[model samples]
Target: MHTTQTFRHVSYLWDEAKALELAGNEVDLFIYRSNLLGADLRLTNYAGGNTSVKITETDPLTGQPVEVMWVKGSGGDIGTLTKAGCANLYVDRLKALKNRYRGLEFEDEMVELFNHCLFDPKCAAPSIDTPLHGLLPYKHIDHLHPDALIAIAASKDGETIMKEIWGDQLAWIPWQRPGFDLGLQLEKAVTDNPNLRGIILGGHGLFTWGSTSYESYINTLEVIEQASEYLNANYGKKRAVFGGQKLENTDAETRKARAAELIPTLRGLASSYRRMLGHFTDDARVLEFVNSNDLDKLAPLGTSCPDHFLRTKIRPLVLEPADTLILKSAEELKTYLVEQFEAYRADYAAYYERCKHDNSPAMRDPNPVVILWPQVGMFTFSKDKQTARVASEFYINAINVMKGAEAVSEYVGLPEQEAFDIEYWLLEEAKLQRMPKPKSLSGRIAFVTGGTGGIGKAICEVLLQNGACVVAADRDRLDDVQTELRRQYGKDSTITAAIDVTSTDVIAESLKQSALQFGGVDIVVNCAGLSISKPLADHTEKDWDILQDVLVKGQFLVTQKAVEILRKQKLDGDIVNIASKNALFAGPNNVGYGTAKAAQLHMSRLLAAELGPEKIRVNTVNPDAVLRGSKIWESGWAEGRAKAYGIAMEDLPAHYAKRTLLNEEILPEDIAKAVLVFVDGSLGKSTGNVLNVDGGVAVAFVR
Candidate 1:
């Protein structure tokens, strides 16, 4: 148990006459008031903190007869105070006292006498920690138990815990009572370690001071953030718990056997009270906890912590063997609601009456949390995502904590009324109001092969912009691609892999690496391919094999591996193949290349039909004359093809452009954007469809 003390003192009684007298006598008081007013407006929770400044004065003309030292005034809750709450004391006098006693104990009476001796009788009482502030030689000091810092301090091993998380960038102090003794200890510690940056009082708060007030405050927040991360890593409560009972294999079989007996009642409750009970199905935890040694003895403790109240409620509904029917669960929920909310309603009415200057909705619903049944365990109820998420996180944390606490002692929580007050507090309610709506594909992942190539890179960029984290695979080194991506976006936005898509072994390794890197894959864009423009007579058997390996065989291997991952993870996936417009409209040269590309298109359509029942979408993009700078551009094939067609090298783009009805030069980026449409589910209700991004070239061929 800890003893709490309160300090209350009259610093300066505000009277117009005394104010006028002080205004005339000391110009410093006016300056201090102006500074205090400025700081108060910018800070949100200043009441929980303190600030101090050192003062130095000099002659305006001739620099002579100056007083210089640190002065700290009364400490009080800053939220409910005005400028007059602060005290002004002579810095030199406090320093002289410190020099005399060296390690003297400072009592409240001593602080009071010191303040009285420094200024006129009308001045405010010096703060209880005035002597402590006076002992520090720094120019500015600020202290606060900011919420971020409190979250860290409240954890076990918060000192070593914080140091490991934040490194040696911050200074830490063991917990101590706040007063002259604490001040003396700090002074000794600071003296021993001259390079101290800040002090973290374990299980208490933080302290930071700098050359300026703003710097001190910012530094305090920076240190607190370090502590918060440390706590979050080691002691973060679970976001939700498995509320249903644990089941043995035998018990699971028994539940299935008895399902025929319970199905009718379960179905009725689900149909009639879907809004209240959510979707409930018999799962393993439900069966195990139901068949546990004695659920009645353990279920009352509810979740492990306060956050659980938002989810699992304060307690779970327990059903005994004799009362396994859904009607019994419904009746129990009704009785609990009537008993709990009657008192809750009365208190809410009183609270509203007392604080009714502003008007909002009465409340979304008084019943945000619920327990389902004993055998079924707990279930949360919320009308919106915010309530649901909050409840989920709470229930998760609570369940873990409850289990841990139960091992040591009975699981206990704050009073029900206290929990209600926090749960319904206006400030907390505002937090729910500010939550962003969830995206449709929030948890989905994707992969893009040949990601370093022009078309592949384009697909990857577009996919990332929409929300999916893409794994970009290429045979080249991943360093340049990853660096470029980080420069364009930032680190970890897209992952990179060095892989030869044609090798079955390499494709398998790449998919494994991608899954480990990006959680899982929901989309695969097989953009990797090769082309060689050669007359049929000049084409070699090896050239055909190369084209087949890259264009057809490579895609087969990549898709085969991707499908295995998608099936194992039970993810609905999409595979978009990048075929060429030449596959649809044959040309005089490039026989092998055209044949392989055509085969790839037909294979994609077949895969689409095969994988459709499994909810995996497969499609292909046919693009023509996308002459962007890439591996093909570096090969000098465009110039050779132009010469073979009796056209100038510079005229090659226009020659191809004229073949399209639109006569537009297609770009790799255009094809990439089209690929994005299929990958993002924008081409709704259409898979196995080969969308052409070829500037109307296919239409010209048909005409």
Candidate 2:
């Protein structure tokens, strides 16, 4: 093991005053310690480390203090973990399970036996690492996959290197899949050396501990900082890193532009089995490695640590496009990737065949989760935005591990069969099986213009609830709405951006953000519009041009630009234009708004016809008299309509409802619901169609 407070590479974020405040509260302090360790990726990747503290708790039945271990639960990230996410188990019971441990093969049964040791029934389920912490004698324990430690852990002479760094204070152990047996090994290794600070798990990660939570936290960072300093020194001594850079860096703008163009196609190919969202980055570290001569050689050898290997797959697919970040054409690009994907699947199948045990789960999706293009940055794909981002981050960690290992010593990855076994582990398969069923719009991405407005916000919320990631685009950014939605639906669910729909350049930038933000747009809602209720006599050229520019030309430009990405993805898509009932029904003092809406309605049909052959669906939802919670209504359109009808402004809802065949009041949510029907796959076969949400207005019914 490598153990310090002073460091150059890692941050010392511990708050002494806060620590003093939490001193008496062990569990909260433990959580604080865990959060600090997880806050920095250098300590561990997201969802990649486990921390624990053992404390005496009053036994409900006996009224006696009993030793209980609190550890991070399965499927929880340490950075965001709370008390609710911790599993509490009787330490004595966990230790007693050793008698029932039949053998190494029977370690599979230990996970089930963990239930017998639960100290709290409602606590989150214990992770497989529970025993790792519970079995140790220390009051606090932290097992982390820090990049600097991993770099040494991944080297061929990792154990010898550990001895060189910490000599007698820290210990070393060979690689073993974590479970009861590995936990036992940890306990014995520490038991044999009472003064040891920690142990290095070869080709895996580091294990550090202390008699106190704060001590454990500091020890973990000290070890990482020492290793980081060592690696930095060695890297400085090297003539070059990663056998020297082989490719030149592309300019940021060209690289980003090319990344956006290819991301949709990359997403299309990655969605070979099921759709996966993508994340792209050109972080300095990522650029350095991808542009290295060793990238092709090191990439195929795969990630060394099990956590890194699990998320990124054993190895990433390396694509050799032109050094300029340009491909010959879309057709050729697809053909080349199709072949590459097929080859990757075959390789994965062969790996599974060679490593399967009698009870191995059937092979998972064989497509590569991480892709490397030399001049371009890395692309990572998964079922959601956060996961994709984490995967990419993990790959970058892997890259750093390789860089460190190669800079000082030869890098090593897990044995192919070992990686396969871990990937297909029956326990992992069960965890995956326990995951909740995907929501209706799961794996779908959406772009909503005017998304901060009442109707648009409702649509974004509904889509988020149904599992779609959304990009909320408006003429100006809605900072509060974005922050609130991210807080509610998770940071991955939606992003907010300002866009001018009338400018092709702005619309193009919006689509680029969409591609980068959430792979590509799967659905688009043209809901940004303002109403000018004026008669032909009152309507001026400015009124007509502004109305046409925003309502008609704006929707056209947004759709036209977004379609380029939709086509590149080669995936089914939907566009919902929010036309009004005024487009169909003649009303006094509504010429500008009605005429522009009519043009918008026809444009949907026109786009549907043009894009239908590419599996893109364009539709319109005509919402009439949505007086409540509508921006247009709030912006005087309601007062204008009330005056034209000779009624009170507040009475517009009743007036419009009375005019409807069903005497029903229309609302922004009703319009939002109408938009959902078009994109939720329930009406997959119906496109180039109009759905009138006017509470049964006879004149506005679509033909």
Candidate 3:
């Protein structure tokens, strides 16, 4: 064991903070180093860990020096820890708040007291574990659920093994749900072992403290390094023992094709609930673990630590190996995935029933947070993409921990009751309760062709408003569209691409970029079209070609590329083509535009029938007179149509509106909504259908 430790003095990260005089040198140094600790995924992941420093400052109210602990505040990641992310709490008040607990059964009451103990009302909510940090007598404290240390601490003989590894230098505290009682217990343990440098909370995480921020941070790394070395020596170096069989003739494209054939069934099953969203990953180590023959035995052992249960649940939903899937046909494969999901849900319900005690909260949604597919790797499900990504990271880390622990002994996870306690613990439950209700199409990604145009931009806006990340693609002027979309939906949620929908190469590249940014698209809106109103005899071949390329050919190429991405993601998808009412009702000198739209209508029906087996639905929306806000009307098309009617350009919109039986002015927003009715899957069993947005255009009604 490389346990002989050396302390290194870390350099200043906030040299500018001292120069700017933004904060005291000590406070700024603490903030800078805390971010470094948070950035290391091996140490702690995605806001799951926290750091704190004790500082004495004169109280403005009392003109007396008081000790305050500046801890990482709630809902803040340590990787981006700012001075504002630290919650300044009075240590004496926090200690006094503990005496008022009175052994309350409900956890929220204790959380309320922690809030009252905060010295600065402007400070963000302190971490729930603030009490534990406060009770320990140290100038600086760091707490992390580092995977290496957690693997050793999460096993059945974790305390015994930790003692043998570190001797009396490290103290062991048995598993306790994080709250007031746990804080009191930790305080007692520290008092009993006055000379201890750090402590390990069984099935939870590790804690290290020192007289300065650098000392505490380096101490954390050294102990984690030692734990890694210990595991490597005892359990075989570099996870060599857990290597598994790799698929023959399998490459990245092959895996993606297999996913398209396999994942839609899983996605279909998961998306049966409006709240569930799915994500797929073929990350190298995850693929190896899922392909391993021993996965059946090891996968169900649960998360590496108790903290992870809130994110991943106790165990993942595991399917049969990829080799088994390869032998089945597409239909057979889908049936098999559905059966596995059904079995997983039933098993989850049974586990919840068994784990429930009288005082325990109701069982969670019973959906597996992580789904382990054999050859295809893993699919993680959550309410949205951000949560799914976080859960995915946690599960991957858990796999690493399990592999290391397996090398030492048969790895053990926390028992059923304890897992339930943490999963339903009020602090964790509060986090979920704080989340806003998801929008109807939340977690779904949509791609809109001609997205810079009036109706197309409206479609993109509606989708973003309903919580879908949008990729807005257009042939030109995309930078302006990008600005509007970013202003409305945030830069992270909106992507803009310049592409000619008529070109397959450009379409493919744009779809690829969309997938790279936001997983894969669930909805494809084909809104790129053009109008060339001319009499059949007088219309030039160039007029016919231009209209066909922008409408018929453009819609075809964009839909084909989107379908490829949708199939690869193996998720339910919608393709809504915006066809004009001119397809249903012929008007004078409209042959070129009408013929192209009519061809699009028939194409939608044909594609719908072909793609339905893959669970991809195709539909069309027709609008008669959306002249009020359509770029198609503003850009010379309306003027040409008015000339055919022998009317002024200003009278065109009113003339078209009056032609409708209801005399309602159709806006681009109206057409966008009509497309959404089919795209959002609200009409679950309806497809190959045309929805009309022109208010009472009886002539344009489907014949």
lDDT (Cα, tens digit) per residue for candidate 2, span 390-418: 99999999999999998778899999988
Between prediction 1 and prediction 3, which has the larger lDDT?
Answer: 3
- Tens-digit lDDT string for candidate 3 (459-497): 999888888888889877788888878887776567788
Best by TM-score: 2
RMSD of each: 17.2, 2.2, 5.7
The TM-score of predicted model 3 comes to: 0.79
lDDT of 1 by residue, 459-529 (tens): 77777666566788998857888788867855546668878978888887677555444434678889887
The TM-score between candidate 1 and the true structure equals 0.50
The all-Cα superposition gives candidate 2 an RMSD in Å to the true structure of 2.2
Candidates arranged by lDDT, highest first: 2, 3, 1
RMSD of 1: 17.2
Candidate with more favorable, higher TM-score: 1 or 3: 3
Q: Please report how far candidate 2 places residue 207 from its true position, in Å.
A: 1.0
Candidate 3 contains a number of clashing pairs equal to: 1
Candidates in order have lDDT scores of 0.57, 0.88, 0.78
* TM-score, ranked from best to worst: 2, 3, 1
Q: Model 3 Cα RMSD, Å?
A: 5.7
| Candidate 2 vs candidate 3, lDDT winner | 2
